[model samples]
Target: MSASATTRFGMLHGTALGEGSVSVHQYLGVPFAEPPRRFADPIDWSAPFEGGVRLAMRPGSVCVQPTVTAGDGFQGSEDCLFLNVWAPAPSTVPLPVLFFVHGGDFLSGSGGEYNSSRLAARHRVVVVTTNYRLGALGWARLSEGRANWGLKDQRSALRWVRSNIAAFGGDPRRLCIFGESAGASSVALHLLSPASRGLFGAALMESGSPIATPAGAAEELAADFFRHSGCGEAQRRGGQAVLSCLRAAPIARLWRAASAATAPPPGGGFLDQRTFASVVDGVEVPARPFELVASGALARVALLGGTNTDEGSGFVLPAVKRPLSAAAYTDYISKLTLRLEVPRANLSDVLAVYPPRPAADNANSRGNRAYLYRFDQRARDDTSEPVDWGVTHGSEVPFVFERGSWIDSGNTSFTPAERLLSVAIGGMWAAFASRAQPLPPAAWPAYRNGSEAQLVLSIREDATAPPPFRVEVPPRARECDFWERLQALVRDKEQRVAAS
Candidate 1:
């Protein structure tokens, strides 16, 4: 295999890997946008490189972000708008292209964290992973309509791929954008944004919803951020002066101020307003994303997504480290149960679906059928954190990327079952990119109205056979019913107030 690949932008020197029947040309750290100004949107700059062979052997630097948790701080240039690509080395025809957005809660993550060479080679498709702005710098709302630079960065990267993937033997028209967690939420929001239409024909979001902050909430957060940075105090000096002060503030100082302002989620919940992830900015995000999707405004693209069996487990892992007692478990569950807003009498019902049953509401309302699945396979490695991570948030990422060995399960090797699951899941994702349907062996079912059936990806234990999976209905249908009823009541109350 050659050590380099030629792109119109420049001759890229990259590493080559052999997987299955093909070789993968893995190129890392390619820029797609110019260095973004503080609080400004990313500027598209994918011009062809005139320089000699560019070494894309390493991932580009991640954007600057403050340390939210221990061992989670990363620092890089503000010019972190870059992307990585993995393509089948020797392709006879153009293959389907997949653009991936990484998940880091809109705070921390990089396109360099994932290596998609195996997925590209095994599926005979091209895979692209990208990095966008994060935290305050990426999501802070400015005086004008400037906001959601991270999302804008993603849009620019997609445009770059559409224009250049053909050189890598990829069909731009058949592109699919997929991601996990915040990345998933970004993909979901893109579906609602006119700016993102036609950039990708389909989407696959994992464990996220298009829940952007309301305009008022976004404004409040921005104000708090300014106050924390002492920029609000500078307003007496004039509005322009405030902007200049913030822009001129050192990156570390800005990071600290932003980190201090954003409050952590209370109780056991993942939504954080101060994180200021996505916003309902009229330009980039035209309207309330859920309403837009519900009205069928953006329904042409196919959608596929689902939460894991223990999606909430990741949020509470830190609390249950020392082998929880019955009372402790109940306390943990109660704090989590409050988020669902069901009656205390129905708490049992809500707890039954903590993993959240896969619903067809997002796709079904648009009269478009979608596919849903529950990734319930628990990893055998539990040594990283003291508690049970149990198919927690972003747990499926390793399998999807076909790098099961990379997961820090404290184990150096994978079980036969784990390896098989990785191959199967990765293959399904590849198949979806190429055919728009996950080719599950037990016959993946297309979601239908009232159909809680989903492809459950779990290791089944049988005395006579190895662990494998089969079709199953959502864990608890009654729980889903209860929540829908509860949500309807809340919606009715809001509508009545609006009418009044």
Candidate 2:
């Protein structure tokens, strides 16, 4: 059956997914911002359409970035600030809205990649996902005023949702901004951003935290981009000439330069020195997000955050390719500590706290009504062979979206217990969005400073049974304490260095 919704700009014709009561109305590739000018902030979409009607059936073009499978190649366009929406059919009352951002290391990914139909239909919530600029186009610090355009694009999308979601039977007042990995980091940044205040009522971040590229590192990345893009002469010319040269360059040339600038160094270290990330721009980002959260400078909103059991596995496994030798592991640790700005004197202490294969931990929020969770579910292949990745980064996304069964084939289909786990996770997320609490007092409790309680989501070996989701204090408490101290030491050193 066909579906349509009248947005502020025009009437949008969409399509329906599934059938009967489980069906959801999906509107795809809706523009939330105008076609962006290179290195400029996103402009909110407000003008009426010429025909007063728009076809939102197909997915929008993703932002320009290197192809995921092969980094050497490029795909997408600069004009890719679009969003998609999924709303339950036959809903009389306005449902809670969940606006999601996709994660791609600030390099790649789009909103179209995630299908939120299961979330919308099963949980009776309105789901929205949107694309932002990526790679150099999104994060390059070419000019002092032009950094973090991708973040601005997200804010613009939130504004769009606030103004128009009621037309689609969504509650703007009950909006929760949620994302995984890079998207999760973006949500954290929004939580810390002054401009983003009141745009969202709650936030959920999975497997990511509030981190920003230092100003010095951002400058180095920009210089590298200029050198690789054949804009070195423009750099000599200085001022707007550099931006002009970059804007005038071919899209392929820019993509290649971005790839080169952000490429991992020879011998492959644990942390790549050259990286593109959101910066602490004075206006938009104001200050370090982690520090703001520590100092209780965050916006007043309900918070739900989590990480997988083996977050570093995804990054480490892809790079190592083989079992690590003692020497190689030590070398990797040294490089990692250096990138983290840990002083050489503290190397031994850092190593003591973070032994190989250590259990991961989550940070506790002080002032907000927060709930934390750790996903301990490992992925299994078609033969039921455990995937070596071990609940690696982004593994929990399918469970949270209730799309585990979509990836199944024959015997590989998600077990009954696994399916139940998906339902439980998705339902918790929706409950948190609809109300501040993720679950009833008996199942999950709100996190407090001293209590530090969190949910551990895992399934038992009995495939036909229900999941065993438990709430308890996270493991590796001492390790978390040591890291907190180390972080403070590093921050103090950085501040002193900056002052000098």
Candidate 3:
């Protein structure tokens, strides 16, 4: 069936489909921002489009980035600023809105990769997903003023949503921004950004926290890009000249250089995945993230965050041989260190902290309440590659979208229980959007500085039923504590050194 809605931009025609219990309005390939110019801010394009019945049945083209798989290379255009919307088909009056940003280390992936039909249809909410600039085109900050085009694009999309989502039966005031991985990082940065305040009321950060890149690192990457893209030859001509030359270069040539320059080795540090990340540019990200949080510079919003049980399994395990020996684990930890030192003590501390089931034992001291959860559902498929792929990074995404069954066959052979789990998780997200609190099966304590209680989502493999779950106590308490202390110590040292 066809579903038509009257938006400020005009009339939009979307496809309608029914799931088990809910009907959904699916609008795809809707432009949210103007086509991007290389290394430039995104411009608003709402006023240009003449109001008419626009068909939004297909996903828009993704942003420019290197082909992740073989046979396809750099397969997108500069004019790839689009978004998709999924609202309840039966027209729920003034439903809460959830705006999503996708994650691919700021280099790859698209908003279209994650479909929110299941979420909107099943939960009776409005879900929007978007595509922004990526890789060098999205990043590559030549100077303070021209950095982070991707972030600018996202903000523009948010502005569009604020102005137009009422047409889709969405409550602009109750909007919540949520994302996983790099997308989650963006959410965190937005929390710290003055530019992003008042855009959304709540945030759900899954496996991502703000880890702003230092100014020097960003500048260094800029220099590397210039050298690699042959823009350094124009060094004497000034920064704007160099930017112009790089923009004029072939997209392929620029992409290859960016790929080669930022690609880190396997088992790399936390900063590796963040090579093309947000920068601490004075305008966008004014200060250290933790400092911003501690100083109460961020908006007062409800936050929910958690990491998978084995966050490193998918990325690090496949590259290593099976039967990961103690030596190999130690070596892997060493390679994962960002600083010159990965002390034996630190290794032992990390090993001690990240066991399958550590207890949660801290209460939060901050004023705003945050809910923390650990996802621990292991796919039942015995033949799944990376024999040790146990709740790795990005693994929880399928569950959140209720698309666990649709993942690559061999990757995740979903059991009936897993599907139930998906329903539970999706419901929690929807409930949070609607009421700022998760529904049943997700009822748990808010995170506190020293609170030991945690909400764990795990399946009962021994139960005869399809999928049975329990809200177990927090896990990995000590490990998280160690990291927290380490971060505090590091922050103190950096501040002291900066003062000096």
Best by lDDT: 2
lDDT of 1 at 492: 77
TM-score of candidate 3 against the unseen true structure: 0.88
All models: lDDT? 0.74, 0.79, 0.73
| Per-residue accuracy of model 1 over 370-401 as CA lDDT, tens digit each | 77777887665555666666777777787777
Cα lDDT of model 3 by residue, 1-500, tens digit: 99888877778888987776777888998898777778888988666346466888998998987776774378888889999999886674898999999888888878888788888888778999999898878877778756878888888889989988988889998898998888988888887788888998878877777766778888888777788788887855784688779879998888877765676647663335336778777777776676666566666777777777777655554654547677656666656654436454443224323321111111134355567677777644424564756666777787888765434332435566777777778888887887777744345766555544457777765544534444544444655566667768989998899999
Q: Evaluated with TM-score, which candidate comes out highest? A: 2
Off by over 4 Å in 2: 265-273, 320-324, 339-367, 381-387, 405-412, 463-466, 494-500
How high is each candidate's TM-score?
0.87, 0.90, 0.88
Superposed model 1: Cα runs more than 4 Å off:
67-74, 235-239, 264-274, 317-359, 365-367, 405-412, 440-442, 461-467, 485-488
User: Which candidate order results from sorting by lDDT in descending order?
Assistant: 2, 1, 3
lDDT of 1 at 216: 82
lDDT of 2 by residue, 1-500 (tens): 67889888989889988833687999999999899998888899988866999988999999987776844898999999999999998789999999999898898889988888888999999999999998889999876656999999999999999999998899999999998888988998888788899999998988777778866788888898999999989998987888899889999998888888887778765455466889876667666665666666677888888777776656653555457787665555556555454343333222222321111222234345778787888654322423365676777877777666324231224677887888888888898899977889778887765566778889987856567778877556555566677768978998899999
RMSD of each: 3.9, 4.2, 4.2
